[model samples]
Target: MDNTRLPLLSTETPLRADAVRNRARLLEAAARLSAEHGAAAITMESVAAAAGVGKGTVSRRFGDRNGLLQALLDHAEQGFQASFLSGPPPLGPGADPAARLRAFGPALLHHQRANRDLYLAAEPAPDRRFLVPAGRLRHTHVAVLVRAILPDADADLLAHTLLSSVDVVLVDHLLRGHGMSLDRVEAGWHDLVDRLLP
Candidate 1:
């Protein structure tokens, strides 16, 4: 068990430990509001009220609503990244590369589903979508695994293809418009991986 606390943000000016905890608390409150009432329900004032802080505190921490939302997304992304990077089992460090590759899809699917509203609301313009840090990180991780499993293949391109298959927007459409279950989506990932393995 790695006990290291991953920094939520990179900063030249280090935040006091208390400040870090306070910001996390506000983000947690905002996430709770988002989960319970939807992204539309999370406002600066509402987050402040939920965190038992003054609205000014929220303002100081995030600058504005968009900044707050971006931070919330980053906070969520960091946890998901950490789970695959260092946490236990097939999703994390302990499992073989092939097993980890198979696990990535379902892990990502659930992460996106849990954060669906926020992801959809904060979605960048189509041209900008693949450029986001979180998306890039996931792609890089997948590519690394693909390279390990199929060194002769174009892992970079294949990673994109694999990720696109379970893309959040596509999954939402399948789940909502086509009534496709997540289990089916996850199974599809496993099937794809099995076919790709030589």
Candidate 2:
């Protein structure tokens, strides 16, 4: 994957410093509400009330409830993206491709678990799911790693398979409904990578 050629997902213009701070404050309020109650509990009025800001401020910041949810998800995703894209060691650029790939699943699992409610609330529709910018970026990253590790393999398809194995909804089901531990889930990822590489 050509990193330089990767398309930016955002089109919004830069915000002024105060606007940035205000946006962060509102998102923090929304996150608190999400943590306290649930994603469903987040509303423009609710966030405004929680942040001690007017409804108009929330509306002006995020446009609507869905927009707010997307922004919140984006906020949660930024750190994860940065870690794998530019941060150090096994999950980042400095590691060998195989090591990086192995680290990706548990990292993703932790990320999704930390932001489970927000991710669930912002889950895109079936038709639009793969079209989401973050998802596409992940696919590209994984595919690049796959190609590096197994040059002859069907990297694109294999990347999809690898990613699907740790997808948040399935991980949630395995954790909540089937009573699987996170350690077990992470072990599954390691095993999957081992099998693929061996």
TM-score of each: 0.87, 0.83
What is the per-residue lDDT of model 2 for residues 18-97, given as tens digits with 9 covering 90 to 100? 78999999998988888678788899999999999999999999999999999989987898999999999799999999
Q: What is the lDDT of residue 68 in candidate 2?
A: 96
TM-score (C-alpha, index-matched) for candidate 1 = 0.87
Score residue 175 of candidate 2 by CA lDDT: 95
- For model 1, residues 18-137, the per-residue Cα lDDT tens digits are 788999999999988987897889899999999999999999899999999999989989999999999898999889889999999999999898788889988889899999989999
> Which portions of model 1 show Cα errors greater than 4 Å?
1-15
